[model samples]
Target: MDESRPTPATPPAVLADHAERMEKLLDRLLSPQTLCDEIARPERLRAAMAHGLLGGGKRLRPFLVEQSAALFHANTDAVLRVGAALECVHCYSLIHDDLPAMDDDDLRRGRPTVHRAFDEATAILAGDALLTLAFDIVSSDETDLPPTRKLALVAGLSRAAGIGGMVGGQMRDLEAEKTDRPLAIRDIEMLQSMKTGALLRYACEAGAIAAGASGDERARLRRFGEIVGLSFQLADDLLDLTSDTATTGKATGKDAAANKATLPSLHGIDWTTARLRDLVVEATDLLDPFGSKADILVQTARYIAFRDR
Candidate 1:
């Protein structure tokens, strides 16, 4: 530990601290209120961009990156920027997910969807800008990682958010809506793993890359990320099924209405609940090697399983 740098925080404190820090970092990254009149930028586009990104959410993906990086004693400054970049990807996804052609959402984070708040064209552009900016953020010298590590992070995020991951998952979801038969378990798993799990796995993998962890160590963290990703989707499915729009800050019951395939949709509530608990155990077991240093990451898995949104 360096003399000037603070000591590692306790688990609860670290989670809270990371949340606050990430929010600030995101605010700086996504704040549209500061754009100048002297530029060639569209004011509405910037506003829509801000509207989508600045809306309150737990920012869970970035937290995974931050906490996972800490487990390896990686540079905090680098992790903060990397976390912010990951957030850009997440916010972009939400914007696109709410578009009329996609989920047809009217609300997000208890407010109007980006397309509703501005217009569909602006919303689409905002998502595009955010998606591209994520790469820009990660590529900058400010992230402070070596070139190899930065390249790895960039490549991983692209794959996670592009055709191989979230985007591909979204396409699958849309196709499923037209089907008469429900998706099989394997299909649902593959879909959710691509749509949601890919980014999460990237978050943990980004941490390992930033820290220059050994391949085997990164492998363990990647497993933890995968479990967390599945747990996240399960909890999200449960929330959509049980929590009202007011509680979740987004439209609830949309999955059923849209006929989207999910584990809870197929297995029912009890099975989903039990499965989430088992995932928590499995995720915790993966962290046995890190012991006390993993306390916050462990709590993060719990939070994902039990979060209100």
Candidate 2:
């Protein structure tokens, strides 16, 4: 990594365009019903699924997938479908994460958390359904990706969402809470990297593969993904310290209450803020080889690090 490089300033206008494209893609991708009529118990499950998956969020993960595909000039529809599948897996994690036994939050995306909107049993089953259906969507015959690449994307996503990745991270988070451990800064970073960053990294790589990216390009994007994922988690931790509930669209100060070690909590706001800036610079530098083609991605990575909400 270069010791110094200017971070790309994401122009408000360009950010708006990216935001608009992201919103439209999310609407189209998530609009499809989860359980079809052919399924015997569609309605009940569908309601539970929609309760958490629908409504609004940043949709950042899917947006990363779409933008990364654009980097390779690939089929937007293929990327959108794959991105949507990733969103399902993400939504499932959030649903399970907010359960009474987990984060215990009653709010998400400006609405009730899944268990609050429906029964706990239904929420549990809905999360399970989304998790299984995510793989189904990727592996289904309808996915337009080539067989080899399709298998690769499926494998990458499964690994990120499973034991070594997101779930394992969550387990560590809970254990941290129980022990009241005052974590080292590096340990906190690792916890979020595994818990939150893993799937985000996978989303970007999956998009690149969907576009038939070369081996070198895939490796470059992986590095970029890892940096941006850490930046996002750091920003989230910073927000927990500074933002209000209304601004964040969720409860603030929850991290401190849960005894979670976070960037600002561990390193102080000034240091964490500087750390975030460094990461944005690092991430944008990685995009230099792609030149002007990756300008939007570079800008978005900055946005992920700096955006207020």
Return the top candidate by TM-score: 2
Where does candidate 1 stray beyond 4 Å?
1-13, 31-40, 242-253
- Estimate the TM-score of every prediction: 0.88, 0.89
User: What is the TM-score (0 to 1) of candidate 1?
Assistant: 0.88
Per-residue lDDT of model 1, residues 135-200, tens digit only:
988998667888998998898888888898989998988887778988999999999899889999
Instruction: Provide the overall lDDT of each model, using Cα atoms, as 2-decimal numbers.
Output: 0.83, 0.79
For model 2, the stretches where C-alpha displacement exceeds 4 angstroms are 1-34, 37-39, 245-249
What overall lDDT, based on C-alpha atoms, would model 1 receive against the true structure? Answer: 0.83
For residue 79, give model 2's deviation from the true position in Å: 0.7
Provide the lowest-lDDT 10-residue window in model 1. Answer: 2-11
Number of the predicted model whose lDDT against the real structure is largest: 1
| Residue 45 miss distance in model 1 (angstroms) | 2.5
